[model samples]
Each structure stands twice: as C-alpha cells, then as structure tokens.
Target chain A: MIRHVILRVMAKMLIPLILLFALYVQFHGDYGPGGGFQAGVIFGAGIILFALIFGLEPAKAAFPPRVLEVLVAVGLMIYGGTGIAAIVKGGNFLGYGALSHDPVHGQHLGILLVELGVGITVASVMSTIFFHFGGRGRKDV
Target chain B: MIDLIHIFLFTFLAIIAIVVIRMRDLFAAVMLMGIFSLLSASLFTVMDAVDVAFTEASVGAGISTILMLATLSLTTSKESTLYQRPRPLALVVVVLTGAALVYATFDMPRYGDAAAPINHHVADYYIARTMDDTGVPNMVTAILASYRGYDTFGETTVIFTACVGVMLLLGGARTFYRWRRREDAGDPEPRP
Candidate 1:
C-alpha cells in the first residue's frame, strides 16, 4: 500500500492530542459529558487511526498483541476487583460508600477506579478488534 | 424550539435511511449508515442527552465506521449484483412490527411528565439524592457506576465476550501469514 506523507505527519501530530483528550474525558467525566466508555472508544479510535496511517506491523509493534490480550482481561478484573473491595469493606456489591471513612469520598474514589477499569477494557478490546480485522489477508501483515 | 430541531433531525434521518436501503454498493451503504448515526447523535445531544450523544459519536461514527471499512477492505468492495426483490413476508412482518411499536408508543407518557409512572418511581429518587449520595455531578456516571453498577458491569462483559468470539472465529496474526505463504506456493486463494 502506497503511504501518504502528509497523512502520516498529520496523524503523528494528532495522535498524542487524541490520547490526551481521551484521558481528559476519562478523568473529567465525573463533572462533564464524557465517561470511561466514551473516553475508551476515543482512545481506541486514535490507535486505530495510527494503524490505518502507518501499516499494521508498526501499530502492532507499538501495542503488542500479547500485551493486548492480557490488558483486555486486566481491565475487567480491575472493575470486578473494585466491587469486591467494597464488599470486603462491609458494603453491598458495588457499594461505593464503603471504600473510605467519608461516604462521599468513597463514592468519588469508587467512581474513578471503575471508570478507569471500563476505559482500559474498552480501549484494549476496540484496538484488538481493529488489529485482528486490520491485519487479516495481507502478505506482509 | 427543541421540537423544530427534532423534526429537522428526523427528516434527515429518514432520508438517509431510505438512501441506505436503496443503495446497491455495500461500501456506500456503510458510509450512509455512519451519517445516520451522526444525525441520531446530534438529536440526542439536542435532547439534553449529552452522554448518549458522546457514545453514539465515538462508537457509531468513529469505531464502527472504521471497523466496517476494514472489513470491506478484506473482502469485495462492491456488493454482489444479484438483485432480488424484497420478500413479501418480510415486508409484512416489518410493517406489522412498526405498527405495533407505534401503537405501543401511543400509551406511553408524555416526554418529561413529572407524574408519569417512571418519574414517580426510582427515577425521582435517583435525581433527588444522586448528588448527596455519589458526589459526582454527572448523574449518568453516578447511576451507571454506583447505583446501577451491576448492569454496567454486564454490558462491559458482553463487549468483552464479543471481542473474544471474533478473535476465535477469525483466527490470528499467524494464520494470515500462513495463508499468504500458501498463496505464494501456487495454491488457490481460500474461498472465504
């Protein structure tokens, strides 16, 4: 596939900005219109764009398939673990108020943790799907 | 004012839907569907559902379009030209379903009716106490992550399952290389 010089340079400039925005969304979600799910998809979209612009091999090298497989499960585990943490702290399942001495603090922390988990799972799964579909059928891929 | 926006968005959405159905080329149809999603997302945003709009824009316009394009690249770009008339039974079924849905909608409460059954139900409590309870200003996130955490967890699980299923069915990086080698060895390209 013939690559475009302008597109590659443009993607290089934009990729980090996209990633930073995704993180901003993930963290600022408590007070704003975005959340883990939206942030994760946006993050994955950035990586997918990287894959599209600079061949699958380079993208895969940057985000290894092996690490992706582990990260996929790890994100879900983080979410589940947060729930269990609340349970062990004597609250009901997913009860955020039990994690800290102050109930509101617990809620804030719990929301942040689970949102991070959701973000990780979503971003990794989306990128993995792209890698699988994007890498298929090419000799060099 | 909102109603006017709703009407305008719906008109464009309907036009896009018809164009998608009438189109023969699969790639063009997929692109049209992306536009359809974008319109719907805008409608959601206009209706004060910013969270839903964000998801729709990212998932519908961003991810799904790219995924569809990737799939298209792997297979034939143009749709098969074997045109077939729509089945009468399918059309009847679709019309019946649409009628049933419209009939059901007539019995539904008016938009944002404070006295509606759902409004008086758990929704009122969620709205009233979410701020005190969750500390998060975004009620949607609070409800999704804390109040209705189990449901969100299940949704994430479902998406995770889908990814695993696709990876299994499609094989992996190694298979693609092997298939290429076979093609280089003068073997016929796999039919699928």
Candidate 2:
C-alpha cells in the first residue's frame, strides 16, 4: 500500500533523527531543554513510529515479546541496582556521591545509568502499548 | 512583539480546544485533540516551561493520539443521537469556579518576575544547590532524577501495571481464534 511505503520511508528518515535527538537530549541535559524523561519519550516515539508503519505482527517479529519483557525487567533492575550500589557504599539509596572515587564522577555515572534505565523502560512500554492495541485481529485499519 | 505573538498563540489554542470539544465525529474530535495538545505545548514553551512542552508535544500530541486512533479503529465511527439533559446547577458551579480562578490570577506575580516569591523561595534553593550537588546544569533534571527519584519510580511502576492490565484484558491471537471457532460452531453466546 502507498501508506505503508510512505510510512516506511518516513520511518527510515525520521527515526534516525529522533534517536540522535535523544542522545543529544541525554548528554546535553545539563545545558538545554531536555533530560532523561524527555529523551526516553522521544526514543520511544521513534520505535512506536516503526511499529505503526510496519504493522503490529512485523513489529512483534522485530522485537519479540520475551525480549521486550526482559528489557523491561532489566531496566528496573538497573535502576534499583544503582540505588543498592549506593547503599552498599555506605550511603543512602540513590546517593550518587558514593558511587565512585570522585563525587562528581559518581553523579555523572549514576545519572547515566538511571537515564539508560528510563530510556529502555519507556521505549519498551510504549511499543508494548502499541502492539497490544494494534494486534487485535478484528480491528479494521 | 513577543507578547503579541503569545496572545495570538493563546487565541489559536482556545480555538483548537473549542473545535475539539464541539466536533461531532469522534475521529475528527480525536484528531483535533492532538492539535489541541500541540497548541498546549506551544503555550507551555511561551510560558518558559520548555521541558513540559516537549513531553506534552511528544506524549500528548504524538503517542497518545496514535493510541486513541488505534482504539477508535476497533469501535463504531458513528455516534448515537441520544441527548442528555443539561444540568444548570452544575453549569453554574463550573462557571463560578472558573470566575474565581480568573479573579485570583489578578493578585499573582507578572510573568517571569525574578523577584516573585516562587523564584525567591524553594525554587532558589533547588536552582542554587542543583549544580553543586548533582553536577547537572539543568535543575529540572536533577530535581526529577535525583531529588524526586521515588516519584519517577512510582510512575514507571504505574506504566508497567497498565501494560499488564492491557495485555490481560485484550486477549491475544490464540484467544481470538478460539472465540472465532466457537462463533463458527453456531453457539448462541455472543463473541467478545
């Protein structure tokens, strides 16, 4: 269908830009109008676009349910693990100052890890929501 | 000059909201809602809340619209002509609340006043301490990810729970096939 082809082309062009923007938002949070949460949503939007264009079945094929489920769990674990790491280092949970030899470096590392977790969980959950809604058999386009 | 642009944007946003609410076709209403969200995001940007604007633009205008459209595809496009009786008491109450809010705004600080109580109090501390403590220049990010980390965790959990509920309630392909097979067998029970 023309819609499919147009969507595919748009996905090819726009997704990369979105991903790059996510990185820009993630790394440049300290200076600009974006951060972990914004970056995560933008990244999720890119994946959602791909899913929308390719159909839910193909999207599922590309990102298996088990893979998405695991990523969701892993993201949570990573976020929690960072907090636990801080606690183990004689600080309270999510105490980034206790993360490494240098307090500032530790903060950077902690933020990065937590942001990665946020991005993963957000992207997975968004795609999962789309898949769930779009995968209904009797639904007409 | 900027004030004039802001006023124009505000007018545009108001029109979009009116159209969204007034539209009879559900699909058109939903699409108009997307426009409404985008206009809201623009309004946020003009209000100097860039981060909130970005989230609103992406989530409200983009993802939420797509989700609504998908759901719409599964349902009837035509609306029933049933009419509901208007509640004059409720209407009066809503109007009174709106008037009160508009009146209260007259006593508030002008837009972006650095000497405002909001800027001088808690916001000042967060803005000052955020850079030294979190090493991030963006105070919002520091506040969200570090100071308010628990709230973010709670939000993530909420998303996960919603996804789980969606999966459970919306039966998968196998269940759909089973239901279809039963329908083919001429059972009196209606199919989901």
Query: Which candidate achieves the best lDDT against the true structure?
Result: 1
Q: How close is chain B to the truth by TM-score, in each candidate?
A: 0.83, 0.81
For B1-192, candidate 2 gives per-residue lDDT tens digits of 888978888898888788866777889888888888998898898888998998899889988999999888988666667788999999999999999999999999998889889888778788778878878777777777787777877776676677677767774555776778778898756766
After superposition, candidate 2 runs with Cα above 4 Å error: A1-5, A139-141, B171-192
lDDT of 1 at B24: 83
CA shift of B62, model 1, Å: 1.1
lDDT of each: 0.90, 0.78
After TM-score superposition, the amount by which residue B92's alpha carbon in candidate 2 deviates from its true location, in angstroms, is 2.4
Go through the candidates in order and give each one's DockQ.
0.84, 0.60
Please tell me how candidate 1 rates in CAPRI terms. Answer: high
| Residues A11-122 of candidate 2: C-alpha lDDT, one tens digit per residue | 8899889989988887777678777667777877777776777666676777787688677667777778888999999888988789988887787778778777776777
Which residue pairs does candidate 1 place in steric collision? none
In angstroms, how far off is B37's CA in candidate 2?
1.3
lDDT of 1 by residue, A1-141 (tens): 227888878899999999999999999999999989999999999989988888788889999977987888888999999999999999987898999999999999999999999999999999999988887776565
